[model samples]
Target: MTIQVDENEQEPWTVLRISGELDLVTSPLIRRRVHAAVAGGRHDVVLDLSAVRFCDSSGVGVLVAARRLMRSCGGRLRLILPARGAEDGAHVNRVLAALGVRRLFEVYEDVPAALDERTAPLSA
Candidate 1:
C-alpha cells in the first residue's frame, strides 16, 4: 500500500498525519517530510501514526532516523499512537518495542496529549 502524509499545523507544533502502509517502498517519502519540516524551521513536530495500518522494518528505520534528525536539530518530536484497541491501536508501538528502541521516543494516545508541554514524555 502507498503511504500518504498530510501536514496539519497547530501553532508551535506541526503534525504529519500518516496513513496507509509504511514499508520499504514508501518509507523514504516520510523521511523526506521529516527533513523538510526541519528545513522549514520547525523544531516541534508530531507524527500522527494512529491512522497507519501497517509498518514494516523500513518504516521503523524511518522513525528512528526521524528521531535522530530532530534531535540533531535540537527539535522535539511526538508520536500519536492509540492505546490497546482492536483496530489501529498498537502496531507501531509493538514494532518500536520489539526493536528495543521505543524508549527513545515520546508516545501519546492522541494529538492533544502529545502536544501538551505540561505532559512529560512517556518512559522510554
Candidate 2:
C-alpha cells in the first residue's frame, strides 16, 4: 500500500506524520522529506509514526538515517510511538523494538508530548 507523509509544524519542531506501509518503495519518500527539512535549516524534527500500519527493514533504515542526519547537523529527532494498547499502539514501534533500535530514539506517546520541550521521552 502507498504511504502518506504529512508535514506540519509544532513551534521549533517540524512534525512529519507518516501513515501506511513503510517499505522499500515508500521509504525513500520519507528520507527525502527528512533531507529537505534538514537542508532548510530546521533541525528539530518529530516523526509521528503512530498511524503507520506496517514497517519494514527499509523503513527502519530510513529512521536510523534520519536520526543520524539530525545528529550530524546538531539537531534533535524525536519519535511518536504509543507504548501501550493494541499492537503496541503502532506497528513501527513494535518493529523498531523488535529490531533493537527503539532505544536509540527519544520516543513520545503523542504529538503534544513530542512537541513539549519539558517532557521526557518514554522509556525504551
Q: Return the top candidate by TM-score.
A: 2
Could you tell me how far off, in angstroms, the CA of residue 84 lies in candidate 2 after the best superposition? 4.6
Provide TM-scores for the models. 0.93, 0.94
lDDT of 2: 0.90
Please report how far candidate 1 places residue 23 from its true position, in Å: 0.6
Error of 1 at 124 (Å): 5.2
33-118 per-residue lDDT for model 1 (tens digits):
99998999998989999988888899999999999998999999899876644377478887888789888889887888888888
lDDT of 2 at 94: 80
Best by lDDT: 2
Checking candidate 2 for backbone clashes, the offending pairs are: none
- The deviation in Å at residue 104 for candidate 1 is 0.8
lDDT of each: 0.87, 0.90
